[model samples]
Target: MYIPQLSNQKAFDSFILIDGVLHFFQFTIGSKHAINRGLVGVGEKYGFPKDMAKWHFTFVMPPNRVLKVPQAHQGPLKDSKLYSAILDVGVEIPVE
Candidate 1:
């Protein structure tokens, strides 16, 4: 299942549940980034448990975009086991 951000002010770009894990995704076209701690905060703000093992965070960016995690953000991101993927041209995500 997938849920898109309904408002521009929302923290995450979308949400997807795959294989029972809830994934929070933030898509960026430029250098803007979302830290893992912020993503976890979003889940907690929405009433999800802080320690939920199945909650994941994903950073989706264009192909060839370098992901630079600032030193300050490395710890929480590593602890959270952040996930990422590239969205290149011609890739299609079918919407039903």
Candidate 2:
């Protein structure tokens, strides 16, 4: 389930939550146009005492040009070469 794109429904939706149900996330709520945003962080962690399915979460944001920070691990190579290796390997990965 998604956070519904808000139009004039903010008042009613204000207290709604992702609830950590299905072990999902807690995200900052905001307007659809990216104005008047608010910070909402929940540190509650969910564990799989029995069912392991809750540990996975997949999110797909709308497409846009992305500028990303260097990854936590740069691997065993220099930036240019490593970037090329990653790109070559990633090229054939399917999106869907």
Candidate 1: C-alpha RMSD after superposition: 6.5
Candidate that scores best on TM-score: 1
The reply for model 1, stretches above 4 Å from the true place, is 2-5, 18-20, 36-42, 71-78, 90-96
Give the Cα lDDT of each candidate. 0.62, 0.25
- Return the TM-score for candidate 1, rounded to 2 decimals: 0.59
> If scored against the real structure, what TM-score would every candidate get?
0.59, 0.19
For residues 1-96, write the lDDT of model 1, one tens digit per residue: 456546674567777766767777877665656554566566666765455556676788776667754424344344454667898877654432
**Candidate 2 lDDT score relative to the true structure:** 0.25
- Cα-based lDDT at residue 53, candidate 2: 26
